[model samples]
Target: MSELATHETSAASFALSAEQEELRSRARALVEREGFAERSLEWEQTGEFPWANVKALAGEGLLATTIPVEHGGNGGSWMEGALVLEEIARACWVTAMASLGEIGVQSQALAAYGSDEVRAKYLPQIASGDLICSVCITEEQAGSDIFSMSTIATDDPDSGEVVVNGGKALISRGDVAGLFVVYVRWSQDPGMRPIGAVLIPRDTPGLTIDEGRETLGGEKLYALSFDTCRIPASYVLARENGFKKMLTAFNGQRCLNAAISVGLAQGAQDAAVAYVKQRVQGGKALAEHQGIQWMIADNEIEIQSARQLVWRAAAAASGGFPNRHDAAIAKVVSNEMALRVTDRVVQLFGGHGWLKEFPAERFLRWARYGPLGGGTPQIQRTAIAREVLK
Candidate 1:
């Protein structure tokens, strides 16, 4: 194991190496420089994707970390990716969301499964933040159940093309994504199998993206409709293996979505702690109160547990270890852990937490949205059960 991992067990308080220390400082500086603290309020009010900050992150090599250096990327590991996402989320959750779409799921898809031509065409653009992308799954009828997707793609024998039809709902970055990794059911295949994915350009004919709607998490999402969208035969990524490829992408995102929640919950905890120090209660500091002190202690415990679970999950994936079951458990616990922590922070703040002036309410909203995004807590438990019993 590397020195970082060796020292991480007993007391994570060990000093960072010269290089690791430099990266952490740089990452922290970037967030502060980008007005990440203020960006959340702006995104909440405007409901617009933070492109400028994302491009800046690209400039910082944050977006390029995971893609291999051979593909014009920095070739960092999942641990680095998690650190970047956490720091970025500390400043602006919306930026983290937008970045997660490109840096996490989209990059992984291109790196692992894309054809040589597709990788050559897209990976550099993705790393440089020149072209933003989004995963096109989660249809109107198929939120968590991928098996129920109605979107269908048919192969044309005459021209060797694939025609796509159906709508993708609540697609993050959908309205502005230059490229989309679209999942579709292969109509020609047996068993109504979900077996096709293609890279669809935004400029393609018969592809229209409606304006994105505002979500409670201050997310910008769109309903993407493909009416006989024609894609070159070369664009089929995985061909008859669509389900596996899509699951790969979803697994990455599910872990990532949980990380974002961890950051938001930590942010809420930080704000609450600061408030308790300054805001007096009963003529004494709120931090001194036994009840408030217990709440603070509980927040620390839950936050640590949640963060460790996320790190373990990230590390397992990076190390190519068996991580699916652990990833699901981490995602579920972190999701609910964050929910409870943030809700408790709000309670600690009394009336101020309920107001927009404080971030507790926002964090609470985001924590609630977490479980529903990747998959519900119930779905996660079912997945865990299948593995444990097997």
Candidate 2:
């Protein structure tokens, strides 16, 4: 038997801890109570940020689980955060992405590398959902190639401020973010240490947030232009080794991104199963068809397998340092798995699947984000190959 098959037969192979299970249950209940499915459609159509949903999640202590307790967080493990994301994404991928931004990548970087003053000022607000943080890394010329980014942040010794000038594309929730952790080329000198990160407030001068750009999922995404934007020197995260630090924080994000993919696939599977059991054709329920049964069976197997990979990466990340290679592998598999599962679910639903009211089509659209965001499947594959070859 395959390793995945053997593990599935074991009772404890995919079991969550009691606390983790409770967290999942509560998060699921909250999403249901908020009418996430209905709201997700509304938000998608309107292109509005879900502030009320974010506040409700914060009230449930589901916003900043990975931040330390002293920083107004619950001090939860990465596994717990991933569990919450999975439950939330099962209901609404947009809201799940928002939660990931607040708690996963940008927030983790600030907590780990931000100055004490920066942390004290922003972390609590983030935990409470008063402020949303966005990470600015992808530029017009540097989608997957971080080193090719042309956005530069020059230090002014006389002015005691950093002048940032560049544009970032495809930034999630850019319109709603109160703060942004922007990655830029800090120096023109020849060296790998020329990159740096800085925090820029949304209202800072010379910072322009463009109109929202429509994606396959119809979520609110924007491009930012910083034309000689200036912020205090203290806002500088790291003048050197900024890229490495940012990448380290991004490993945790990759895990959460994988969890989102798994959750979305699971959601699609559940909807398909429920529909098949109720919809009858040829004087019999759709679920009674052997071909339909095979489709459902395949979905279950793939979802379980992808979920295990997500959990493994999250578990590895619970330690101080995340395993980059593990994160890359999990992300590549879960992302592709989500696209496949959602497509299968759409097939299972037949003509009704294409309708917006059924949610299969919506899930399919959102599933496209998995392979493209956080990191592309090709990029993850390349990273994994490099690690293994070394």
Candidate 3:
């Protein structure tokens, strides 16, 4: 508990401790020094992976924050990881997303559930930035409804291997990842009991990655086809009944996703503030006008509120993964909050906000990712409602 930076305000405010502040500062400095903010959109435009951003974050020990220290990582709490994500996102949403591919759901599932052989072989490499992981979950029928997912994995007892066949859509980092954390169904049953996950290295014989589709954030989403992709049986991360466990893993993911949303909104607000104070309207700085001031005030209020929700989700995970309820509410609030805040910032920037050269549009695009990335706000609301109904 002491590791988390708690505040005096209502015991809910997520105030930064000296160490957390330094960690946040370290992430910000790395982004600034690398010119990540300036070159943030280059990855999408050039269709290149942000390897430099990945390497820089990996070099600074930020990429390995979610993995346990025993695995050659920082063993930081969810809060620490959220802090790093928020700061990096504030500067460059692209870099922050790249960082998430390392420090987010796939890394978490592999670290928390992978077999000893799998963990030993990959965790060190993952911590060192020598390997990257992509989580394969969504499919044509399976974005929010896991029951509709068609990806399947089966045991081949005689071969000492597991075989997988099915396709995944909208997979992030598929082009660059060395490993894939695939969500699969072990049985045709119509319930969570049949759900499980497995790990397949990128070089596996039967796996094929399609040319990616460019996204609003400039990162590409890929389609993956596993034509009887087979790997050692040891590659299984979770067997039957694993969906419940992985849901726990995803709780942290929702928090980090929310953290990134908060960052994008805050970044937009920051940009708006600088612009408003300088850009004149009616012979006066925009900041001098009461209307502009209200916008700024509204942005701050929303940003602060979203940050606290994200932090609460992160901090509550100290006991382990956050309970689904907290993660759901936080995710819904933060995701929608980002849309409102960034939209306001875009309005504040007026004409410049529509241009690619300005950070405003980038932040806006980045903010759009939050609600869809972890889980849609609708899905989160359903989860929240489930808790409320109970």
Give the Å shift of residue 134 in candidate 1. 0.8
The global Cα lDDT (0 to 1) of model 1 is 0.79
Query: RMSD in angstroms, candidate 1?
Result: 3.2
Per-residue accuracy of model 3 over 1-390 as CA lDDT, tens digit each: 222222222344767677877787788778779887788778758867788888888899998987888888888888988888987888887778777857877777777888888878888788888898888889988889877888899999899899999999999888889999899999888888888889989999999999999888788899999999999988998889998998888888898888888888878887899999999999999999999999999987887787888888888888478778888888898889999988898899999989988878878778888888888999888888888998
Q: Report every candidate's CA lDDT.
A: 0.79, 0.86, 0.84
- Which of the numbered candidates is closest to the native, going by highest lDDT? 2
What TM-score number comes out for model 2?
Answer: 0.95
Which residue pairs clash in candidate 1? none
Candidate 2 per-residue lDDT over residues 148-175, each given as its tens digit: 8888898888998899998999899887
Global CA lDDT computed for model 2: 0.86
TM-score of 1: 0.92
Candidate 1: regions farther than 4 A off: 1-21, 188-192, 319-322
Instruction: List, in order, the clash count of every candidate structure.
Output: 0, 0, 0
Listed in order, each prediction's TM-score against the native is 0.92, 0.95, 0.95
Residue 212 of candidate 3: its Cα lDDT?
Answer: 92
Instruction: List candidate 3 segments past 4 Å from native.
Output: 1-12
